[model samples]
Target: MWLFVVLGAVLVLVGAVWALQGFGMLGGSAMTGSTLWAVIGPIVALVGLALIVIGIARRSRSS
Candidate 1:
């Protein structure tokens, strides 16, 4: 549903930011350069991508 798409988009955006911060590409945070965030960020982004795919698939089926 639209909700899934919205949530997925938000997650992707947040994950990207977290990843950037974790990689020290984006500064000004305690999480900057943290290995934990660096690892988890990609996972979260992947999950968001999955959600978006699932939402689109369902939408297409329903239509």
Candidate 2:
């Protein structure tokens, strides 16, 4: 449960960074302004959010 939360948080942060870079909002690499990253970043972030929600819900139910 805690592990999932931490993992999810990390994923979310990473996804956000990717998205920023993809959109050219945070330039400084080959991935910056890349269309592929722009598309994939949001999807990854959503998955992370889902994991966080699921982990928290499961933890609460078990408690």
What range of 10 consecutive residues in model 1 has the weakest lDDT sum? Answer: 2-11
Pairs that clash in candidate 2? none
Tens digits of per-residue lDDT, candidate 1, 27-46, equal 99999999999988888888
What would the TM-score be for candidate 2 when compared with the true structure? 0.95
User: Against the true structure, what is each candidate's TM-score?
Assistant: 0.96, 0.95
* C-alpha lDDT of all candidate models, in order: 0.90, 0.89
Measured on C-alpha atoms, candidate 2 has an lDDT of 0.89
**Model 1 off-target regions past 4 Å?**
none
Residue 46 displacement (Å), model 2: 0.6
What lDDT is reached at residue 61 by model 1?
93
Per-model tally of clashing residue pairs: 0, 0
